[model samples]
Target chain A: MWLRLNLRHRIYAILTALVIITISGGLVMVWYTYRMERLFSGIIGRDLVGFQVAAALEASLVHQKGFVSYYYLDGDPEWLRRLGEYRQIFKERLREAEILSDTPRQQEILESIRSEYNEYIQIKDRVIDYYKTGQRKALADVHPQLRELFFHIVDQCEVYKHIFTDQIQEARAEAHDQAEQLRYVAGAAILLELLLALFLAFVLVSHILGPVRRLTLAAEGGEGPGRIDNEITALSRSVRGLIQDAGQVHLELERSREHLLQSEKMALVGKLAAGTAHSIRNPLTSVKMRLFSLGRSLVLSDTQKEDFEVISQEIRHIDTIVQNFLEFSRPPKLQFQEISPSTVVDMALQLLSHRLDAYDATVTLQRSNPLPTISGDPEQLKEVLVNLIVNACEAMGRGGAIVIREETAVLPRVGKAAVIHLSDNGPGMSEAVAAKAVQPFFTTKDEGTGLGLSIALRILEEHEGTLNIQSAEGEGATFTIALPVKGADT
Target chain B: MKTGFDILITDHNPHVRRFIAREMTAAGYRVQEAECGADVLFQVSGNKAVDLLILDPDLPDIDSAVLLQRLRKRTPALPVVIHAFSSDMEDHPEYLKSDRFVEKRGASIEHLKEVIQDLLIRR
Candidate 1:
């Protein structure tokens, strides 16, 4: 379920869980704290107050006894005043004790304490009166009873004191028990919250950060193979695909950059050729005319006529070079037509059969009975094929087999196209020569015009095709011309 | 046919102009030379006896097409021939007005002479 949800929904659900846990935990803590505070105040305030009141009543009763004893022994009037003061204090204490009683047994204990305390106060007064009238014997006889009454008051007060002390102890024990229970509940709640938070953190880190880290690793080209996590592996795969796409785009850009530079270089060559042709062609015309005039006017030996013929021939050669230069600089318009690619190849092969026989070279062709028809200029395409075949034949001066094949091929970005493969088992070209083979005026052969491949390349370009050469030293050379299949683009 | 009728040959190159003039002289026609368009206009308007004009389209002083247009207005009845650097000139009105268009190096001097004789015979 978590995997099915996208990142946004998962985050929302997790955060909501965290919020609820936090709020409920806070409420539990607050409620527990309030209960604990009330328990704490009850234990300290009420229990301690009961203990203090019982202690005060015991001290007052003891003081009254001491005052009566002093008056019997020394008969001082100050003892009488002290005894009255203690008696007033004992009454005040008894009144406070009565008000503090809550339970029925505690109320009964307070009533017995009130009665015993009043009897003690009455016995102390009788002793005080006997002391004041100078009845020493009577006071002596009352002193023992006063002593018994004081002890009785002490006993009841001790009972009342025990009750307050017992209450204080019980309240403390109960408060401790409640506090212990609250500690367990609060501790459990806190532990649950902590566990929940840790779980949430684990989920958040593993789900969110793990995939992101894997994605980063993939982007950095550092992802290891055989990833286990489904989500992270998928993210890594996507990143890898993106990288591959970027790499393909980069390769295409590099190809276009090289193509553009080649075009610019060709443009420069055209301008230079045009200027040079213009300057030299006019002079060549004059030379031809002058040579003809000399031939017509001079009466000379065979040697002189031969020399004039040689001169005319050399002049014609220069004229041919100039004409070829102009032609390269300014290409003739293509006469486009729809023709069978194989038919054109066959026509060029048939034209070259006589030449192949002369070179003692054998030729072979793939049986393409009815190849797809493509739009092209048959004459120009034939010229391109013938040039390539002648080049192959020349490379194999010692004689070799020439093979031509055709197929439907698919190119990168550009779709299906027609391909003609012409392979020659001859002396293969070096990498340097292969690199610059199609550049104008670059030739390796002694008598080559150096414009054949360049011209062929130009013609193929007009048909939106390319000449691809593959060669290595001591191996064979293969030239593949890839032309677009159907909708022709000039 | 007249034996020594005068003809004008105009070209920037001295060799081509002189060569053609020599070829026409051998054919028994009086040949005059002009180096520039102004010279052709000057010689044509000055000499009423000039029988023909052979013009090269590339000239030093003036555009050959402009010169031809101006010269045609001045000498309407004179037969004109264009010696071109390229063969395809069916598109130009000025060139089509000429009685003959021969590509300079494309045609032999013998072919140019044959054209000259044919045009003079017609005249």
Candidate 2:
């Protein structure tokens, strides 16, 4: 869930958590230290007060004994004054013990110490007064009682000191245990802070830094050192899609460029053909005239006559090829008319009838009836038909049946149209040859001008029609001419 | 048509010139062949008194149009026929003053013979 947060929010959240953990750890340490300090201070303070009261009471008892000795031995007035000061110190020490006692047992012990000191002080005073009257026997008997009272007070002070010492020991042990616990807590707090810092670093690396690095690599086309994640994967897929789209556009551009080059080639061929035909025509005409004159002037045997006839025939064939080239260079301007496609087809067939028969090829004109009149140049249409039929015949060198069919069909990029199919049962062409078949000046036959289909395709294109062919190796070829119908869009 | 009138033929192709010379010579006209523009000028300035000039526009040595203009200045009344290839046979207005033009194509030789016979008969 935290990983889904955006980078900024994730960083901010981790920082906040780290801060809170640090502050809470510090607070826990402070609270533990304060509680331990208060408990240790309470225990040790009561014991120190008890020890002070015991020491003061012991000093007071020793001073009282010394003062009584001085007064009995010298009977000096200064000794009496010092005796009073000792008496006052003893009373103050007892008062301190009374105030220091809190528990009922200690309070009761302190009350006994107070009463014993009071009785000893009163007996010492009566003995001092008898001494002043010169009765030493009274002094001697009371002194023993005073000395016993001082011994009892001494025992009480020793008992309170022992209690204070034991309590102080207990306080020291308790404070030591608490100090050990606080040290452990402070150590745990530091460890917890370290863990928090480490966790934030992990989040920054995995959630923020790692993903950002991956994103950078994805942007730079996966060339960097980063692993793939979903966003990067998706970005790469789209980039690939864009590249593929550009590739397709480049392919289309290359195809269009090829077409432009082919057209340019055709234009060059036109210029070349025009120049070449005229150059060759002059000598050809001269040769024909000379041959005519020679033939008229001389008589020849039957064999020589036959040879002359062959030469004349070959010369005529050359002339025809030259004429064909001239025609290719200058196609006739189209004269559009509504003409029956069947008429043009039949006309071409009749013209090639002899050649067809010589090849022993049978042509089946399916539905030899009148097709719907299409708007096109009849003479040009006839020429297109003648060229295609002649090509079909040439393809079927030995003999093969050709099927000619006509019908209304829908063509791609054009509407409903009239389609003519001229199929030959001869050896078909490979896909490569079939593709370049309509390109001008592309020829397979040694004697081919390669202009037949090229001119036909140009003429058909002038009428906004298309010539398409389909063939596979070893099978026959099918040449299809699709012309838009009368009312159909070109 | 004419027994022995002087005529000049100018062309770069020697074979074409030979053929035309032979045909015109057989027809009884005194025929002379020049292979270039300089040859035309050389033959025309001589005492041959050329009656007609048949020229092909493609010349080896100097521009043919310039030679034709110079030839016209030298022999203004000499009937001139341009026997040119079809592609170069542009009927420019400046060249229309030539007596005739015969495009080298089908029936061009026959037409040239007729033009020559007519020009000779008129001469």
Candidate 3:
């Protein structure tokens, strides 16, 4: 029944039981005290008083005997006076005993004593009269009857005393019995109180403290039992840690969501660019053909020719823009083959040799050994290298030395990879520009298509590789391309 | 009537076809224009001996793969130069099985003229 109640109800029940027990014990104490008071008062007020009166009656009666005897021996009138005073005292004591008597038996005993005492008093007076009138023989005849009446009155007084004594004893025994009953009640109350205290302790330990201990253990991941003294404090600290972890996870989710949004925007731009470029290509080709034909067949002055040539160059530039857009929009399918990146680097350098000479740039290839073979498209890899080298050449304008370093190294997250570090002695981009360097259509050059780095990044991403650019303003830029090695952890 | 290798230029755009036909005619080759896959098929199956075919392979009616397959089955010996965006055919290598793959660009005509000349001279 106790277990069925919740913690709150159980506590209330225990406390209420304790209160009732305490109140009952207090009431029992009060009732026992009141009963004891009544018992003691009965013994002191009625029984004891009656017994005292009975004793006084016996004492006064004995005093009367001695006084009469003394008067007979000495023939003194003072003895007769003392005997009379004692007789009055005996009568007053007997009357007081009669007034104090509550039972019929006690009253009957008092009535017998009163009648016998009155007869004795008359006989004693006659004996005194005979003694005063010179009648010794008459006095001698009544003296024995007076003595017997005195003995009888004293015996009745003893009976009355015995009655009061018995009543006083009975009241004492009743008080004692009540006290014994109260003692038993007190013992039972104490035992009940002890049981209640034990039950309350059990409820506290099992229902309250037990759950708290378990919560503390769970909060602490059950590590080092009893290590923390305060379970509440430990639980609060654990909750705080959990909140912090959740906050960190929320922040990471926010960052990833932003990244996903950016990727989605890029995809939309790619689709738009592809559609626009495809439509523009056909018209653009016709214009170029017409321009070429006009340039070949028409006669013109040097200025007109320059104007014509400039128009052609601008048109070609537009075509290049369109081409870049198309390529950016339409990611080419990668043709994967087992090939060394070193070979691709050599091919790009060879292909861009004339362009490098035109830009007054120097090319340097550094490799300890042929880098490990990777599954990649050689043509696409060469295009990425060409774009990077061209970007460096343009950034430097002249006298830029491009170093292409190839090596096999273990990269974090990408494991074993063929690392290519293409560093250039050129005025590097600022932090802001470098950060946006690989984004589409972000460029610093006047004639740049701005899709070179982005396309290269995309191509490298397709190959499960990464392109990282490290640069500071006024310092040269190093573009690192890491391609995971074939049959290596990626 | 010109006395030279008969070359057929196929493109969806009439302007592009006219441009290529003019350029090829100026280059001293007999030129024919076919703006769709059906025209190219009709011309190739006809009595007019087409020495070479310059195909953009972006016909509206027929899929490029099926068009190329039909063209190949008809004229196995005739040279077919695929003229389309490089990105368009980058994923479909089957389109590159033609005699030539010319990326359509601003300077594509010059390259196309060279390919046509080479193919006709070889034929």
Report, for candidate 2, the interface RMSD.
3.0
Root-mean-square deviation of every model: 10.9, 12.2, 5.6
lDDT of 3 at A433: 93
What DockQ results for candidate 1?
A: 0.32
User: Candidate 1 chain A, which ten residues in sequence have the lowest lDDT sum?
Assistant: A220-229
What's the true lDDT of residue A234 in model 1?
Answer: 64
Candidate 2 structure quality by residue, lDDT tens digits, B1-123: 457788898878787788778877887788899998888898888986788888886786887667777877988877888887644544354554455887654345568888888887876
Q: Please tell me which predicted candidate would have the highest TM-score against the true structure.
A: 3
| lDDT tens per residue, model 2, A381-407 | 999998888888888886889999988
- Candidate number that wins on lDDT, 1 or 3: 3
Error of 1 at A15 (Å): 14
lDDT of 3 by residue, A393-473 (tens): 988988889898988888885789999999998899888999999888988889987889999999998898999999998
Give the top-scoring candidate (lDDT). 3
Clashes of each: 0, 0, 0
Screening candidate 1 with a backbone cut-off below 3 angstroms (N, C-alpha, C), the clashing residue pairs are none
